[model samples]
Target: MGFCEVVEGRHSIRAFQERDVEDASLEAILRAARRAPSAGNLQAYRVAVARASSVRRLLAQAALDQGFVAQAPVVLVFLADAAASAVKYGRRGETLYATQDATIACAYAQLAAANAGLGSCWIGAFHEDKVRAALGVEEPLRPVALLPLGYPAEVPRMTPRRSLAEMVLDIREDA
Candidate 1:
């Protein structure tokens, strides 16, 4: 599919089939994420892949009772390593760059999943404390997003979106 098709095809899938996602496919998705542009190439983010039943259960709790998280074949937890960038670039790195890096990576992963005929949802409504405990993450590393991946069971209708004219601004001033 073309890029526009892929963009149109991508949706936030909430229901998934029981089919398991292969390791190779998961790696391909990660590769796409790695291709994302990072601030100064620091790439101060890490992703934790969780597929085990027990771990998925805990992740479901971390996601605030979102059972689909447990049902998906793969759950990718995107982490922001503030200290990694802070060490090199200091305070602004911690405040902005790390989160940007993580979010961009997650976006790449989502597009890659769509291209691979897999479905995905970017989850952000979870409790941070629960995610830390469930994933055994140490201090200063924050969970930026939770992504669930698998074959979609239900095809969702397109959600409403604003047009570019409404969302974008042209700053050119007439002389």
Candidate 2:
């Protein structure tokens, strides 16, 4: 699929098959995330790979009982390395750029998963402290997103989207 098709086809998969995700597929996702653009090229992000059922259970609990999270064959936790960005960009790096870097990387990973015919869901509603504790994340590294990956058991319908007229606003001074 082309980039546009990949973007359009990608959806939040909540139900996953018991089949495990291949190592190669997981590597591709991580690689794509690494290639994601970051502020100052700092790449102020890290990803924690979780494949163990015990770990996924803890993550699911941290995710507030999102059972599907635990069911996925693999979970990739995107973390913001604030200190890494701060060293180069100062306060803004710590407060914003680091988060942007993590978020962009997660987006790239999601796309990569879709391109590989794998299912994934981007989860961000978990308690921060719980996720940190569950993943054994230390200071200066903040969890930004939880991506559960596997073969999808269900294919959700296409969700509604705002039209370009409603979502876009062109700012121009000349008529």
Candidate 3:
């Protein structure tokens, strides 16, 4: 699909069918994430793929009891490696750039899933400490998002967006 179509089609899918996502599609999604731009070309982010039922259940619990997290066929945990970024850019990289990298990668993954006719929800409402423990994610790898991906069981209506006049800002000396 074209870029606009893909973007328009993408939505936060909460209900998923029981079927499993294909391996090739999963690989494509990860590859798309890998291609995301990052600060200093560091790509200081890591993704943990949870396919096992037990782990997904734990992750769901960590994500404020969001049952859809466990219902999806795959749960991808996006993490930021602050230490890795700090190795080159120091404090600023650790505090901001690393997190930005992980967020962008997660966005790319979501688009990829949509383009592949899969559904996904970007989950941010989770207890960080609990998520880390559930996924065995250690130091410097801060959890950014919990992405649950699978085939859709329901079609969600498009949520409203702010108009450009309200959201954008234009500043020029000529004004």
Candidate 4:
């Protein structure tokens, strides 16, 4: 499908098939994430893949009892490596750029998963400390998003979206 169709067809998938995601498909998703544009090309992000049941259970608890977090065959934790970017761009990199880099990478991964005929859910609601502890993430690396990926068991309806006229604005000085 084209990019527009991909975007329009994609939705958060909470129910997934029991099968594991293929290694090649997972690699493609990760590769797409790496290709995402980063601030200064610093790639100030890291991804933690959790496939073990124990780890997924811990992540589910960290994610405020979101059972679906553990239901998928794989869970990807996207981490913002602030220290890596801060070395070059200082405070702004640490505070903003790294977070943006991680978020954009996650977005790319989601799109890639969708394009590959797989399903994924972007989970942002979680306890940061618990997530870090669950994934053994350390200081200077902050968990930004948790993505659960697999073949979907249920199809989600398209959620409503705001129109461009309502969401955008243009300004000019002259009439």
Highest lDDT among the candidates is held by which one? Answer: 3
Per residue, candidate 4 scores C-alpha lDDT tens digits across 69-145 of 89999999999999999999999999999999999999999999999889999999999999999988788899999
Off-target runs (Cα >4 Å) in candidate 2 are none
Kindly report which residue stretches of model 3 are placed more than 4 angstroms away from their true locations once superposed. Answer: none
Which scores higher on lDDT, 2 or 3? 3
Model 1 regions lying over 4 Å from their true place: none
> On a 0 to 100 scale, what is the lDDT of residue 171 in model 4?
73
Q: Residue 107 in model 3: shift from native, Å?
A: 0.3
Global lDDT of each candidate: 0.92, 0.94, 0.95, 0.95
For model 1, residues 107-149, the per-residue Cα lDDT tens digits are 9999999999999999999998888888888868999999999
How many clashes does each candidate structure show, in the order listed? Answer: 0, 0, 0, 0
Q: Which pairs of residues collide in model 4?
A: none
Q: By lDDT, is 1 or 2 better?
A: 2
Better of 1 and 4 by lDDT: 4
Residue-level lDDT of model 2, residues 9-104, one tens digit each, is 998899999998989989999999999999999999999999989999999999999999999989999999999999999999999999999999
Greater-TM-score candidate between 3 and 4: 3
Cα displacement (angstroms), candidate 1, residue 161, comes to 0.9
User: Considering TM-score, which of the candidate structures 1 and 3 is the better prediction for this target?
Assistant: 3
Tell me the alpha-carbon RMSD of every candidate.
1.2, 1.2, 1.0, 1.3
Give the TM-scores of the predictions, in the order they appear. Answer: 0.96, 0.97, 0.97, 0.96
Off-target runs (Cα >4 Å) in candidate 4 are 172-175
lDDT of 3 at 141: 88
